[model samples]
Target: MNTPTKRRGCFRNGCLALVLLPLLIFAGLFWAHRSSQALPDRFVLVVPLSGGIDEVRNESSSLPFLPSHESLSLQELLFVLNHAVADERVREVLLDIRGIHTSPAKIAELRDAVEKVRKGGKKVTAFLRSAEDADYLLATACNSIIAERGGFLLLDGLKVESLFYTSPLGKLGVQVQAAQWKKYKSGIEPFVRTGASKEYLEQINALLDEFYDDYLGYVSKRRGMSRSSFEALINNDPLVSAKKAQTLGLVDGIASFWELQRQLTRKVSGKELARDNDVFVSGARYRSAVAWPQKGESDERIAVITMSGMIVHSAGEMGEGIDIEMLKNSLDAALEDKAVKALVVRIDSPGGDALASADMLQMLDSAAVKKPLVVSMSGVAASGGYMAALAGKTIFAQPLTITGSIGVYALKPNISGLAEKIGLGRDVVTRGQYADASTPFKPLEGQAYNKFVGASGEIYDDFVGKVAASRKMSIAAVDSVAGGRVWTGSRAMKAGLVDRMGGLFDAIHAAQQLAKMDMGKKLQIILYPEQKSWFESLLQGRSASLSDRFAAAVKQQVLHELLPQRQLTSMATFYEMLLTSGQLQMLAVMPSDIIID
Candidate 1:
């Protein structure tokens, strides 16, 4: 019954079907991956806290074709917690505390957020497999703390260590010539001395004492124990098993993950579930299911500009530091936007170039004149970072924030001995007396050293003057607290350096109040220096290409194979800081390399 025309038509239809089938399948898979899963009627939100917690979200990925692995930021965590407060469907919040690495300031912020969740009528429980000092501190904010049967708690006291390279560099025949404006400017001490100076020792011991007292007070008060008892317990047994922790009232219960899930199910639904998955929703999925309360469609907006890392004149790589040009553009855009009623500048920098910091301060001041500006200091905002913050109408910092290193220093490396050891020499002819002042083969002395000292003094005086004007204190009072002295936010507040002791959210609320926005109504938030995807960054020249990145990785591998990686890396980093703005520039930075373990 088949004819030639019928056979041809059948073949054509078969070919078309084969091509369409693969296209349909591909489309289906894409939709499935992009779509959000349906939420259950009532479920406990499980939030896993781990890894390094940053202040802002990072969108870069190694491979452009694949999605980047999500890392948690304080902003995102806060957004989720704030949304959960009003969400009636969420029965409870389960914080799965793992190996979390962040500053004490961030930990304090998160603890406050957990307390706010409890205040909103939802119980927050912390589940720990093993806990460190910071983990225990955060867990105390929860309604109850549950630990795995075999877990341990390491409650070791805090210790800060300072590394010095003076001996090693001397062995290499390289001497560092450093001139600081004040005695307390210990940033250069590590380069010049084998041990900490007396002044530095005094400052560091004071900082540690304050931190230890604050830590003891917070933990003891939260766990319903006297300070002396808690101090004695930690001193006696820095490490405790789960059973011991329970008996000591540190943990409410010792149970496995499944047991905790069963208890949660019974508490929420009045029945135990056969499967743990039936009652729990992950924080990642929950984020997709619920929209942020502050991100409502509103014409009124508050622009948040994040200035993290060192304050540099320009960055060679993206996110290298707070570049002056980038800050200028962000400020200009916020000032120009009519919808932006207020601005919140979050600073988390240890400071860098003195000139760039002054530029940033000027930009913020100009922006503030047109609209309200508030500064929120993160973990470490010292030296030039503090200078830039002077423009804020009000400044907010957490209790553990390290701020106020109001001084300047200049460093010049004299490598004449190294050159002699290596049998290398240079003959120079100069027209001017100070022409060779910056040469590495010569040590800065006589008129050259005097000139640099005068410059540093001027910069230091200007810094103190700005702090005095901003804090409304006399020059003597400001100087008394200044001179490269760092203080915690609580002490800074008492010293009249900070207007309030709070976190980023508090600063946002202050901005909202200043803008005259109704506190009950949610307003939109606009992030400055807007986050970009990897592909977009490549296209816009903000990020290096794949080939360039590959080359960098190869070079890093080769260096690790060739050298003592840690020491070499440290030296390279220090050298980079010296040359960040090109030439031997004076730095208004802090002793940021100190490690608090």
Candidate 2:
């Protein structure tokens, strides 16, 4: 009844439909895989506090053919800990702290979370393969600490190391002229001096003593030992074998991981159970299950804006760093949100560009007028970090947080000697005598040098004045403790710089009190500058060829060996600060890159 051409067309259309159906089915299955993954009803959450904990998580773009490497985030980890404590399905928690590298304040926050879980009647156990000062400090927060048999325990007290670039610069025929507002402002010392200045040594030693005392206090209280006895144990033998540490009562037991799991199961149920009978869920997996908005039908919210990393004009890439433009936008968004009852600004920065810091301070100051604002200082909130904190109604810092480096300085790099050594010359034309005032090829002198120093003095005066006004102290009192000197949070509190010693959540509660919100109520905490979507991340990520990756790897290794990672990051930030200021400008950056181990 039909023509042969019509029959052939129908046959081709049928083939097309068959091919498209399989593709659609595959896509649907792939999309629904996450929903199908079942979470255990009764499980122990195993949190791997391994590797560096970035303040925020950002995924870079890569080819579809490449594998993805995702790291854990501090914010998400904290959220999981909070959720698990209240989660009826979670019975216990196990923290695996092998090969974990993080700053002191982050460790403090983690410890606080662990303590919360313990107080919530859930058993928290920590297992360490190699225990160091930071790792042991975190382990003490757990209900029980387990270590691998014969593993190394390096509880040696913290020491901060600094590198001086004077000799190296001299050999390379480079001249670095720098000026600070005061004598104790040592941010420029590394490039100008061969050894640690007397003031710098005094401040560093005092800080070390404060941290050591705090560490001893915590361990002694947790282990039920006298402070004197604990000090003796640490001083007599800071480094010991895992078995020795267990014998000394530092750790509860030394056992293999399988045995530890069995022990944990018994602790949870008071019955010996086989490893296979136990159910465990990873932190990331559990976060996926629980880290969603459980917002009580209330419209009121509390905005927690995280300003971590170097404070710069802009953050070009993801990683961790404070971008002024981004922060301003976040503040504007929070201000615009009528439901936001209060604002909590968490700062973990060693500081950066003065202008950018000023801009952020202005934004925060403006916000405080509208809402109750509180600041929580993390690991290293010195220099411009402290500058920003002045805007807060109250400031809270972890006991070991480094702060109070309220000073300013400018650096001028003169490479004329290096150029001459290489037999290079340049012909320049200028309209004014100081036209090339900021050029690295020539030395700054005469009126140029004086002007630079004067500007630095002005910025320092401004910083000190702000601190005096905020802390209700005299200019002399603020300047006496300032001059680029860093302080432990305890000392800062005593000095009237910090209001109290606490973690970020504590600051949030403080904000609540100020906002007249009820205590113990779970208020919605909103993160500003919301994270990007997967598609947006892919667009932001620009993939490089294999050769470029190798080069970057090599460069990273060299920098790692040459200096601490923080120092390298600070150096990059320093250059960025210069570029943003567009002049021989002053910087409100920490004098020393603090690294506690």
Worst 10 residues of 1 by lDDT: 563-572
lDDT of each: 0.80, 0.78
RMSD, every candidate, angstroms: 5.7, 5.5
**Model 1 bad stretches (over 4 Å):** 1-30, 60-70, 262-278, 317-319, 429-432, 533-576, 579-583, 593-597
Q: Candidate 1, clashing residue pairs?
A: none
**lDDT digits (tens) for residues 329-348 of candidate 2:** 88989989998989999887
lDDT at 424, model 1 = 96
Weakest ten-residue segment in model 2 by summed lDDT = 60-69
Every model's TM-score = 0.86, 0.86
Residue 125 in model 2: lDDT:
88
The CA-based lDDT of model 1 is what?
Answer: 0.80
Error (Å) of candidate 1 at residue 211 is 1.5
Best by lDDT: 1
Off by over 4 Å in 2: 1-33, 36-38, 60-71, 262-278, 317-320, 518-520, 533-585
